[model samples]
Target: MGGSFKTQREVNGLFELTDSARNNLKNNAYYNDDLAPTKLDERTWGTYHIAALWVGMSVCIPTYMMASGLMAQGLSWWQAILNIALGNLIVLIPMQLNSHAGTKYGIPYPVFARLSFGIKGAHIASIARAIVAAGWFGIQTWIGGGAINAALSIVSPAWGAWSAGIWVSFFAFWALNVWIAHKGPDAIKFMESWGAPILGVLSLSLMIWAVTAVTQMGGSVGDILNLPATYAPGGFWKIFLPGLTANIAFWATLALNIPDFSRYAKTQKDQFMGQLLGLPTTMAAFAFVGVFVTGATSIVYGEFLWDPVAVVANIGSPIAGLLGALGIAVATLTTNIAANVVAPANGISNLNPQKITYGMGAIITGVFGVVMMPWKLMETAGAYLFDWLGTYGLFLGPLAGMYVADYYIFRKKTLDLDDLFKGEESRYWYKNGINDKAIWTWVIAGIFPVLGKMVPALSFFSDNGWLIGFVVAMIVYPVLMKNDTSSLITPEEEEAMNEKVTG
Candidate 1:
């Protein structure tokens, strides 16, 4: 009798433990307990890292192309410059706020999504974000490959094999990136630290060269400054609003995933200062210099040249052109690794917390980059995909809303951390670890904004999808999930939950 009673108690404990584990898993579906979170080291990064991030982000082909496009839209040069500046300011706010969690928990953005989106739903968002990142990886690779081809042609006329050389160079750089990324976060951080500074110096050098050349040609700096007005229209607000919105969306991926990087910071202050110093100031400086160089190109070349690589090629000096090409390639690679590789890797890792390791995540992400053939996407689709992808802001908006609402409005920012890991019976395991109200709200709210981008009649909302999606999600999520009380967890229950997260 005694033996049988002991056996029964053991069986009961096992069943209860399994049930608890299932609930925890459902609640924290998006996070991976297996991956060790990064602890920030205050000494390693300071204002400079932040500044370099902006330099790397701003001094890219897409940003310049967008600035030029805005100019072509009939806004004056000053108007456009102001627009870019103001736009960057707006993007900085949310980034700073979101980065706090990363610094505190050392978890990436997709993991953070579990606070609001439920575990599984976060994957949906992660996949969307990853798809966009993969596309960008391919596009940047293509651009870098072209630069290699151009440099090779100059070095040896026999290397004039354009298509073959371009693809070859593309694969070479792609392979290098794969290697770097495979080394994990430390490698990515080291590259960002060193590569960012070098790229900044090169960009500044290009600007100086352009200015000096313009002055020697008997042209005043004023002439170059005056060019943007002839191209774009309206004043600061008109240009500023669209430019600001577009840049915010363009930079949204970085802002949203900042936790991925911030998790490495030593303290919240380190993360905060890094964001304040890095994103806004650096982005502004890059924009200023970019506009200055492109303006000089307009005056000297007699036509506007927005692509930095093209600007360097037009300089007519072999050495200078080669240096410029190399700089752009380096800059693009830095971003590809930091922004493109890291976020998606975390996203995929979250999907199967037990099965997908960080190294595996990196490999899978790189493979997707190849399969997507980003070069084909950019060359064939043009800016249409960017516009289409901008619609993602709609989903992000609601997702963010749910996060802020759950933490601040509903749960009061005090999460039952243990419940996050428990299985089905977990208060968080709403309907088999899925939160239908949040998911449905996100889908419905995202549709209109996406349609706005695809349909010409709805293009008016294209540039402002972030705002639109945010507003809709904010209203819809709360209302839909109002009667659903499963998300609520008491303070005492939360404490009894787990003190440490277990894989």
Candidate 2:
């Protein structure tokens, strides 16, 4: 009993709630042990665990694709690595700022969103996040399915020659992914911790293989260091700015939903050290592997290869090809479950807490994955690079800016947690369970970056979408809330709260 906080017994007959916080909220779709604010006793993750989570996620096909995809577009090996480093380093600032709210308050990102976006307005942002995660799930599934089919073909080439085998493999891999995601957060945590060391060892082995293969082909190692760019059709700033935007956006999903994991941190130091060690270093190291391996493939096979699955498929030796492809499949499995499924599941659950559980949310994502047919988006260079990554940066950019500005600037890093779950008459329920100001702020900031992408002449806007959107929200949000913090608790409310706690 943290004051006379209202928990709805019923909201427009949506579901029965009660002043009894435990009995009312626990089984409701909105209330889960996973989604609830973490009590002190629940914070258990250490720096090592956090670091491993990053490594497991980083040593995957997307990280490989992120680097290779950039090089395939026009970046030098060094340029691609540099951008990855810089994008990740810059993104780390917002990620850390967002993580602090979670680590201190023990709330997941959706709950965190309530402060910035209003109680129900947060759902709008939450669903946007879920959409991105679902799209990624499908893309990663296609990759894993392709790899599995390759391995199966090595075992039985004639069967692999048929399209039926690929379809079968795709369905099989999808089912596996759904199973892991459905098992819930604990399974994801276990996979990240247990799978990281294995994947890291595999990454080193792949690098060693690439270097040895290139050497045998009489390819100078120096060739990779100085490969000429094939497609820099635009000026450097034009190319670099847009390319850098894509890089920042690559992990932007995690930037928003990191609270899903960081809330489990045993200490802020652990989360900081773990992310500090994990993100840039692992991304840089993995990008290096991607650049080297793709370059080595060009020398050996006389064609640039972007997809690691495609590279492994043509390895020629049945044993090496099958094992390498299987390794990639496993890596994708770890990444899809950890990176794609968790955020969206939590987000979808946040939308209708009485109806959707994490398991149901995960299944909904799988259905969307099937409907989206994400393989088409990955079929070409432009589709993979700009269409997916650049476009997502448009909307997500505003989100990043809004969350950072709201927490750091407006509220001054302070929040009222008990009011967060209160159904009605809560200060957060500004207008009909939504904050029109926050909704409009997101819309205004979101429009510019998205417009940049649509208008062919304003490519510069697209190039700098996330950066601009973020800056706009940071500046605009403070102005909107400056004279109107009726939403915030006044000194009198704090005194009353204190009396309730003390008395």
- The lDDT leader among the candidates is 2
Q: Residue 451 lDDT in model 1?
A: 79
Model number with the top TM-score: 2
* Model 2: residues with Cα > 4 Å off, grouped in runs: 1-30, 232-235, 495-503
Estimate, for each residue in 1-503, the C-alpha lDDT of model 1 and write its tens digit.
Answer: 01111111111111011223333344343335543344223224445565556556655656665566555555666666677677667667667767766665555677667656665666777777787677667767677776776777667767755557778888888887788888987887777766767666776787688779899999877877867465333444444454556666767777678777666565567667767776766666666666777778777887666666667666677888787788778877776787778788877887887778777878888888888776655542225224433444545655555555555566655544334444564466666666777788777767777777679687656556676666677678777778876677655554344233322
Cα lDDT tens digits, model 2, 241-276, are 777888888888888989888888877788899999
Mark the 10 consecutive residues where model 2 has the least summed lDDT. 8-17
RMSD of each: 6.7, 4.8
TM-score of model number 2: 0.92
